[model samples]
Target: MFTFLMMLLLFVPIGITVDLAEKVGKMLENDVPFGEIAFYYLDFTVYFANLLFPLFLFLSVIWFTSKLANNTEIVAFLSSGVSFSRFLRPYMIGASIVAGFALFLGMYLAPIASQGFNEFKFKYLKKNKSVQQTKDVYQQINDHDYIYVSNFIPKTKSGLNFTYEHFEGNELKYKIFADRISYVEKDSAYKLTTYLKRSFDNGIETVEKETQKTVQFPFELEDLTPVEYAAETKSYGELLDFIAAEKRRGSPNIGRYEVVKLKKWSLPVSIFILTIIAVAVSSIKRRGGMGVNLAFGIAIAMIYVFFDKVFGVMAEQSNFPAIVAVWFPNVIFGILAIYLLQNAKR
Candidate 1:
């Protein structure tokens, strides 16, 4: 725990400093207030902490165990008739504690921090790039109503080539079409341009057309336009409901959201996997002392991170199953941990 805290202290500030340096110009250009800037940094600290959590645990374990090996403590302990399995008990307990904390962060705290962090980023650093906009969206507002938009823009609360269909018992009751549809805040209603409404009743059709019209709809802009990183900013329960709703809406970002959802659980499991690997690799005494163990552990950590990012990208950018992308690193490292533990037993 002490080593973990030390690693956290060492790395978080460095991350904050590097980020501040890069974003300082943007903050100044946007004329952001001092308080908001400070709050953004705090959010960024949480974001980075959650991001580098596994690396932090991995390195801390390597450092602590390597020092013990360098000082001959590991040899002394083993020579005193403590089996390797017995020696691993305390490390497992420590890993459980860290894993619980990481789980809490992923499930709850990280979402709040992510919201603040991403909000500040898109608000200041990358203006006019709202995540709530998408192209060619189709959604079922209810069993009886459907809507589509060729392009939806949240900033203006408007859409192009908007179409709405009302159905009753597998029959189209009416359909509405508009060249443009927009929400009017003052009136709490929708304004449609080049509007046309067609109703069908017992094979008799009635058509109503207008250049412009004001009307009410059963849905709101928020229902149609979800933020791209909405998954990251939602609690576990909320994310599950959100994912279900998105699935109902035929959202194209299912893979990306699934990856985020799975990682919340997978990260805690990874803590145990990494801890075992660290102890196994560092428990053996070497002529080069702790240096060799530290180097080897760092390399493994980097490779783990590389695999995680590559697989995560594949899941986000393609139809690859998110479960595989999220769990593959843990499986590979779990195997490594087993192999190293067996060798250390000798």
Candidate 2:
């Protein structure tokens, strides 16, 4: 905990300074209130704390354990007949505590912080209108219902070149097309301009056209719009439900959401793995003392981080399964931990 706290203190100021410097100019130009800016930093703290959690745990374990080894404390304990496995008991216990705390943060607190962070960025920092939503989206609203849009604007709750198609057992039952559509949030209705509808029955087709129409749809505006950070903004339960809903909709971003879900579990599991590795590496006194252990620990941490990022990107961009991507680093490091433990014991 001491080492973790020290690392956090060192990083927090730098994080705050960089964040403020990046956003201050835009905030000042937009005349954003002070309270909102403060709230944003609060969210930033939570987001960053969760992100650096595993590294903090790894470094903390290495720092204190290396000190114990350097002071001959570990030698004394072993000389007194304490087994190395028994020595690892307390580290495992401490890792459990840290893991539980991390789990709680990931499941509950981080989601709210992430939502606020992304909201602030999009609202105040982002100047490009196109960045708000994606263009040319296609989604299945249900098993038999599909929707397509050429472009969507979340600010106006509107889209252009919208088409809704309904299929019944390999047959096109009905189709709706509009030159433009806008959602009325207050009324829970959709306004379609230059609307056209076609109904097909037994190979016969009937068409109807309207200049403007207002109608209620079963789907919400969010269903039609593309959200880049959708997974990050949802709590654990909400995330599961969102994933299920996305599956029903046949959304193309399921891989991203699955990655987020898997990562919640993976991050906590990594705490235990990294703790073991840290203890195994640092519980032996080296010729160069603490510097040797610190250097080695930092290098291992970097390798773990590198593996995490490479796999995470593969899951996000390619056909790689998210569960594998999330757990692969832990699995590899877990083997390393065992190997190191055996060597340390000998």
Candidate 3:
């Protein structure tokens, strides 16, 4: 617990300091209010810590066990007829408790914090950028409907060069075009400028044009933009529902959303796997004392993080299965932990 607290103090402050250093200029330039900045940092704390929880937990385990090895406590316990597996029971129990807390954090608290964190970053620190795709936005809204926007601005909930197509089987039923489109919050509809519609019936085509029009579509304007980053802003149930809704729209980001959703659960499983690896790696004495074990643990942690990012990218960018991408690290590390534990048993 002491080591875990130390690790928390070590990582959180360093992260906050570096982030504030980089973003303070933006805050001043934007004239961001004091209360909003304070709340932003509060959310930043949870968002930052949740991302690196596994590393901190892993290091704390290594630090605690390494001290036991350096003090000959592990030797004393082994010589006292305590089986290796028996010695691991308390650690596993502790890991389970911690894992539960990690689950609560990722599922509930992190989403709330992440929403605030990302919103503040986009609103103040990243004014020149957007959370959603800003150009060539296109999607199949449903089985027979498709939508396109030459460009979009999420901040204004508006787009340019908007087009919507409806098909009857392989043939076009109708198509609509607009020079500009914007969501009307008060009316709960879309306002299209230079609106034009064409319909095909039998062997004839009809055209209609309007200078301005208010229309309703089966989709929301927010649905037109990229929503992978939005996944983290939703709670557990909300995320699942959002993914399901996005899937029906033939969203290309389904894989990415699934990655985010699965990652929440995967984190808890990793706590157990990392705990085993830490204990096994650090419970054996070495000539360099605790420092050697810590060095090795840090190296392993780096490798684990590398593996994680590689798979996460694959899942997000390609057809790689999100479940495999999320759980593969835990599975690989779980095997390593077993091997290391066997060696330590000898």
Candidate 4:
């Protein structure tokens, strides 16, 4: 409960500061209402809550454990025939709870909140929003087929430098290049209209007859949607489908999504491991004191982050299994925690 209050306290002000600073900067040259700026600030801050949560959990653990050690409660438990592992059981439980909360917020609440925040930015912050918008741009229209728009305006569903490619296995089958493409709203649906098409056949190029609508392909142009911003934006159910769909398509960036999905579970597990490790590291009353405990804890945390990031990058570029890549750091540290627990008990 106390930890939650601390998180709330830190989250609100930081959010406001960020929002107001941007608003003030924007307003110095333009006239925007104070109330609107305040609303934007609130929205910005709320969206950042997820990013702030991990630090909150880490600091809370450190502060709480430091107090426990300062009071010699942890030392007394170890001296009373209580194994360090047994003593750390509650800390593990607490970490699990925090991790659960983090997962819930990250997977569910954050996505919904992010939509509002992004909309606010697009509507208020962006100038010429249509020209700047980019979503549903370059998309895989079908297997072995791709559509790319050099720039797309999502609001108008218009694109410039449109290029479409069809591939047979690894060989290029047909390529169509267009100067511009636009979507026409028909009744309740939309139709894509192209202004130009250059088709390549038998290693020869010909300008296909230009028309607003043409059945020149095996796949429909409208079938593609933008790649999702990130897995975190999708619900847990959506994330599963997204990953499966991408994997089936032989998408390269799926490693990032895989890591994200695993992270939902792994983040919770990490809390438990770190709690055990912290208890083991701090169980002995060291001459260097809680400062030593903190330094060691921070060092371990930094090493964990470093390796996690490195593996994440490697996984992106290589054929490293996403599940293994994401969880390897945790597994290594978990073993370290167990070993330290045994040593500390003696």
Compute each candidate's TM-score over C-alphas.
0.95, 0.93, 0.92, 0.72
- The sequence of per-residue lDDT tens digits that candidate 3 reaches over residues 1-346 is 6777798998888888998898888889899999998999899999878877778888999999999999999999999999999999988887888788889999999999998999888889877777786788778877899999999888889999999999989999999999999999998899999999999999799999999999999887677886448999888999998888778777778889999999999998898999999999999999999899999999999999999999999999999999999999999999999999999899
Query: What is the C-alpha local distance difference test score of each model?
Result: 0.91, 0.89, 0.90, 0.67
Query: Compared with the true structure, what per-residue lDDT tens digits does model 2 show for residues 61-178?
Result: 9999999999999999999999999999998888888889899999999999999988888888885644334588888887798998898887788889999999998999999999
lDDT tens readout by residue for model 4, 51-99 = 5554455555665677778888887867789876577676667776777
Q: 312, model 4: CA deviation in Å? A: 3.7
Candidate maximizing lDDT: 1
Q: TM-score of the candidate numbered 2?
A: 0.93
How would you encode candidate 1's per-residue C-alpha lDDT over 139-234 as one tens digit per residue? 888778889999988878898999999999999999999999999999888999999999999999999999999999888777778788889999
Please report how far candidate 2 places residue 223 from its true position, in Å: 0.8
Q: What are the runs in model 3 whose C-alpha is more than 4 Å off?
A: 142-144, 155-157, 167-172, 184-188, 202-204, 226-228
What shift in Å separates residue 144 of candidate 3 from its native position after superposition? 5.3
Who wins the TM-score comparison?
1
User: Which residue pairs show collisions in model 3?
Assistant: none
Task: Tell me how far the alpha carbon of residue 173 in candidate 4 is from the true structure, in angstroms, after superposition.
Answer: 11
